[model samples]
Target chain A: MRRRTPAESPSKLSDVARLAGVSLSTVSNVLNHPTRVAASTRTRVEAAISELGFTPNRNARALVVGTTDSIGLVVFDLKNSLFVDIARGAQRRARGRGYSLQVGSSDSDVEQQAEHLRFFDAAQVSGLILAPMHDAPESVDRLRSHGRPVVIVNHDPAEANVCRVLVDNEQAGFLAVRHLIECGARRLGIVAGRRDLQPVELRVEGAHRAARESAVPVEVVEYPVDGLEPEYGDRMGSRLAALDRDERPDAVLAVTDMLAMTIISRLTAQGIRVPDDIRVMGCDHNTAAWGGAIPLSSVSLRGEALGEHAVDLLLDEIDDPAGHVHETITIGPSLHIRESTVGRPTATPPA
Target chain B: MRRRTPAESPSKLSDVARLAGVSLSTVSNVLNHPTRVAASTRTRVEAAISELGFTPNRNARALVVGTTDSIGLVVFDLKNSLFVDIARGAQRRARGRGYSLQVGSSDSDVEQQAEHLRFFDAAQVSGLILAPMHDAPESVDRLRSHGRPVVIVNHDPAEANVCRVLVDNEQAGFLAVRHLIECGARRLGIVAGRRDLQPVELRVEGAHRAARESAVPVEVVEYPVDGLEPEYGDRMGSRLAALDRDERPDAVLAVTDMLAMTIISRLTAQGIRVPDDIRVMGCDHNTAAWGGAIPLSSVSLRGEALGEHAVDLLLDEIDDPAGHVHETITIGPSLHIRESTVGRPTATPPA
Candidate 1:
């Protein structure tokens, strides 16, 4: 630390006024409303600020206000590709709204997710968005009663009237199954993510609807896995193979592309040709599903839109907590059809 | 914005001072330095604050010291997987240091990067870390001339004597080729990322060194594709197969694991098997790479460690700007040899 000279010992408005060649009242005006000061005067006062290397004590400022200026984002699993996109969307939207986002991974642990909220609350963040692994009843109550704007992302819980930003996971499942039926797939299987999320349950319901609507026998087999990883896909592929000849689904629909990619790879290991033998499809047009023998056809959720909407809702809540309303916005899982879903034995030319 | 009620305004310090039966300075001390004031007085002061929703203006505090409690991180390309990993690493590291990171993507344009820099400077970010796309000499000079702490993340211009955080990409390239050679991969083809990055050039150099050292008749073919997307992998696969069995290399080295996954998929489509028809490998053990028909042996660059080290270096620079210390830490591409490189080729399994 630099030693302070006797001249710098006044330690108040009068000392700063003397150093900046301005009156104490002018210094007060500069601190309160900088736009009211002249450019030349502003430059001089700013120079004095840099030379002194002073830090206006936040503790003193905190005496007047309750908290600071930052935002927190809580994601359940860092290991999932879906959350990577969600985090990106949130970061971009938060940047535009004039607050920095602090991201943390829960790794599907309820305790870790709650811990993040407590840490952010202690630091006094402006707002928060959490994608919980399970329905966090106690934690949700604490956050809501704590008097801050909190928007839930990707997943909906058992709570009443909380703000949510999510995509139509059911529509994604419907689209995948409908495409498989078009490809002459008489039977289908599913590689799913964690069952606790609302999207997971909703998607399965949509796929069941498509199968019943088509009057075909659909084999809904859940890949026995913990979190959504590639290993789950590999396990799901073998599950399909182990079934009876009539029970083996001609098409397998994954809740996530990561799972689909794994199923495709492992299925290929067992000498099954995609589409020609059994067609495998997935949701989330993640990069991993593409660039293969037959690029997997899947759904694309508008990531940036989900992020932008979350920010907009949070800002509205912060501006007027009582008068502001809570709402839910469900975006898309737009289809990006590729070669994997086409049920045909082909000798197509390489591009 | 909501209108403040008369009841909320009464919790002001002057009102609190009158209500608590104390002076204005005493109320201020109770808020600023709780220990300095009497506990009885502090309780009265705290009761008054909770009644009011007063948020102290950070701008007012910054006017006195000219410092914002945030850091700036501007990356070259948001679409690139490597850059995304770097940004995540930087953000994680920056958070541990109690600093919020402000991120911006330049989209491979020098003008946009500079514009982002100017905006960040005006916003008064505490410091900046940039991966500049276009070398804006004037802008770089101006940013450096200012007292803000700056560190360039990826690219080194050499003249600036700036702080940097990077891995030895060229050595990684050389090692990939050497590993292939050790496993009897004589014929070689390389798929590289954008040439603008110094790592690409370095990797090619490493490949050349290994071929030179082994004295094996190493024939190399370079595919200069667009950004390191999986599409590039698909395109490269056919190019490799277009050659006669004698001309086609027995191995393929992709700059990224994403590309490697695509290459394996496309090769399988063409009825050519991995490790049997050709050994496939890549850099960066990204999770998706492992989901393929064959597991690619990859050079794992410990992303979390890279993040932690960069923050340490940046903080050191911030603490002692005039120390003239140059510390260049070289990390690794630790090779993970898996199924794609050495396993026996099995029959193509079902999809």
Candidate 2:
């Protein structure tokens, strides 16, 4: 059980393989995929590793293999469940492909994003998946210039030469508004935050298109907010509730499920029924939608799918950098119908 | 920008300093804390870096400095907002201390947790903060044996010799049940999930203590579930709704906010008015409580504070490993009263 001192040089995989009288790949299989190695051979390798005190040095291995079995994921915010879902998806895919995913939250700060990128670069991760914010193209260029495989997730970068995966937000907005219209709505309201954001802009565009394509004449009103906090939704809800019954929009679609949940809460608190009076819908069918008192109807952005696709693209580039072609993959959004838009059934409860 | 080929050895800080006719520290300062170095010297160092195609090798730097400028955090579940809050707090603290935080989600898997620990070990992180699950003590031992400074978070380990930070779950349970009694409850029910979990057991114990301390005779019912999923909450809510008025508990306390939210949603759907028919409360005052249709009343675990404290302990260990004593710091929980426990205010809407 003696441990190596700082002054002593560490044993290598080669030393363990030589002592165990096994091939290098056999020793590697015993270390990484133990089930792939036979019991007797694995025991012999283990005894040799114990005798040699061999701890695999990832950096040295990376130098030999040209890459490490790790991928770095940089996201704007981890507080948002969407990013967590994406990380989970990416982690599962990476693990399946014999790679580990390391996550760093930029917290929406440009400096933090840059620092994470630098750290990942220094770590020499096999590849990187960035859900970027604020001056992303420059960051991507910097990473690419360093000969690192990069995959942009949850965003369509301005540069088309890099691999990217994003949810079709415009289609998400279209599906949400179209669903509301189908539920017999003439007046529609779109609750939006930060108009300059690409996803927000695309969703707004889709909403407008939905309004324009309506068979019956429909009025679409945009309620813009500074940000997507629940307080903003509460303010909007209070304002909506203050309006006369006839003046209020018959249907509303918040840009995100969080805003929609807050709005529903506020409206319900003020004695305003959800679907009975004004139907409501949201995008990013996040966990909040299901856990809310009124199950929220929302457009699914498919965060996990976006994450998995980003990793797929990253791995492809990592495996064959010479023949890699950068591509932008867009995942289509789907609609989820729930009690918020459609009132609960009057039938007896299930036994 | 011409890049060096893989065949060429990366430039060292000493080489950059020599090229710039400056000290090594000056080159280091320019790369790290740039404001500390003079602008003229920084420009010269930048020119030297560009001319030499310098890329700092983190592994080599770690070998020189004995550690990397990073901390590793392994959490049971990043999907839970509580863990995310902890990570956010730890990241901010680490960044302020000139360290980067790398996070990995175990998703309640033991092998995943072990993988993260191994990855961090390979990366030579300065320290580690682990929110462990399944054989945590052995895992912590394995990490400590590797000469890594470790701080356990969210879970108090079996080995008291290890540094750990956790919420006072027993006190959390007691606070929740005490609040219910103060709100005039004669019959109380504790809605718990996964009885084997230490936190759940502690909270239940605290609930019993609260009932014993009540002046009036109170009946405490323990309603145990297989797990904490929303569907389990729904099932429990239905069971409660089906009970006779005289048999039903006047107040119920769920182990987590997520369960409380789902219960509220299910109860309201079944014409069982919360607080009016049965006052309900929860522990872990997570974000779901605030975002729910009925703002939930619960006990706050102070996850961010837990995270921050974990980092502080980790840093202390890293700085003075020889003098560091193993300590278990437990943060007290507080109650948040909202519309769920007490019905919405009767006051008229504000102008």
Candidate 3:
């Protein structure tokens, strides 16, 4: 048998007022700002709320506050630590403001992303934070028509009239290649995943830019991986190892930390020495990359900051919908040079 | 200033029926089982549903169908690769069933876990999947009383009147130690984190059981870490490296793969040759263990399978409310012997 509440409808503010023998505004005051109500009266109102199981109806509440107390976040891949860090930052900020969060992963599928957006729209979340893969502009328009605020992450909003939180991927790429060049690496291998991805292309472009600007002549080779996974990296690692020592690139930069770690493992197993033979670098500065078999050198994309600012941007839009001016916030990337690039020994005891 | 629907109330079933010129049952039939209604009738009802923006009230619909179309999942730590794999599997299964998943991380805090649960209950998710850190029984009771079904992951239900999806932690522990013993290790050290945690205790119990079963007298030593993280592991690694060669154990197993990898890295940096000097093993078989500098030997806890089965258990409860009996599903663990134990060279080209 299904459970049912005795009340005809979900408990209401009026019902709470009636049960507390107080005016409607008194009950509203107690709920909206308990400090305004006398302590004894607030206790009575809270008891009434509990007795009636009165959940402040979000739809009705939204009409009063101009938005619901819930935020929705959609990511390209939830399994990635980069997105996990973003979600963590968003959660911290949302909790501080007494809001709940709903999360979804599109699994890199545009249709799935669209479906998640539709769900959020119907659920009536106050604001949305999306680390978009595709259809972001169209989806943003659809969501905005429902009178909800949307913020995009990772992607450069470009000319779109939307808020975006981004990291300078091109600068991160330039830093990686430039550092390798400074380390006397003239021949470089770029382990790229999915050319269609904007971040991947931008990183490659930045690497080429840095190479062209270098005083020494440099040759950059591209090694394409079919997917953003370790399996693809493993396959590429084997192929790279087969190249004669003279033919192989002296340094490598993987698109993501996962690729960097897997390729390094395979390369090490093939008797190739890291830094001594070929320095390896990765993007995203993932948590896994730090304590793995090799501490990977990476461009720290500041995932947590991106997530926090995205929520801040969305909330700003939600607060001033009519006069809201869309703004794009681009965060800079920092490089963490660890064992893979610098041949630094682990466990250096504190000074 | 707030957005409001034009209708006095969100369009009800009656509105959908009247607009389609059909009875309430016919509208319900069209929505729930379209095959029961004629194609023309179904089209008319769907059009009315779209026009009125009638989102079948989930609270009202649950009285008839016993459940909603949303599920909630909470993990103790989102940073752990173990929980990420679990979430990925749960999301995939939830999507296949046409349900949306909401995810939260408790950050190993009991109060945070309770808050997430209360939020999930208020949001009215039909079912919840939790990888709980503390207060399992109390939290389960609170949610159950609110007519929500919950499935616990990692923790054994242990005769509780609730559904649970667990991996054999005791067996996983036994396998780790037994494998080391089989590989000719006589003295062993176990890096344990928080003896109060049931899983940790259970794993330790299993390792002791394996040691007792060994024919040769084996010395088992316990090294306590304040937390189950890489920092603690690094601390423990330094201490072990400083021990006299004659006093140090020939093999070691950490409670988790995170600890194992860090310890291995630290020991390697301290000039300790793994396997040749002291073999290292870990539990939970995290993805990071695979591509780390050492390629750690670990007991694969099958986190994804546990997550997938937990969803199945929750859905079973939702589908057959009265007939559903709580079940404890225990998945077995497997050992992955890698370079940390075997120390084999990588990348031999396949013949």
lDDT per residue (tens digit) for residues A1-351 in model 1: 244543453234334556797754455446544786798998887676556643333233333443224466777654455665776666655554445455556656675466567655654667788777777777767876887778888877767677888888888788888888877877667666677777777777777778878865654554546667777678877877677777777788888777777777777777777767778887876764543444577887766556666765675566457655577777767876765677422432322
Models 1 onward score TM values of 0.58, 0.73, 0.75
C-alpha root-mean-square deviation, each candidate: 19.9, 14.1, 14.8
lDDT of 3 by residue, A1-351 (tens): 123343334555556777898765466457544786899999999899888777653344434554337788888887677788888887776654546576778777776677677667766778799998754787888888999889889987655788788889999899999999998999999999887887888888888888999999999999988987889878887888889999999999998888888888888788777778888999877765543455688898878778877776676567557645566767788887777888755443323
lDDT of 2 by residue, B281-332 (tens): 9887676444445668888787877787677667657756775556676778
Query: lDDT per model, in order?
Result: 0.66, 0.79, 0.77
Give the Cα error of residue B89 in candidate 1, in Å: 9.1
- Tell how far residue A234 is off in model 3, in angstroms: 4.1
Clash list (residue pairs), candidate 3? A293-B292, A293-B293
Instruction: Give fnat, all candidates.
Output: 0.13, 0.22, 0.24
The number of the candidate with the highest lDDT is 2
Off by over 4 Å in 3: A1-68, A229-231, A242-246, A261-278, A286-295, A322-324, A338-351, B1-68, B265-276, B287-293, B344-351
Candidate 3 clashes: the total is 2
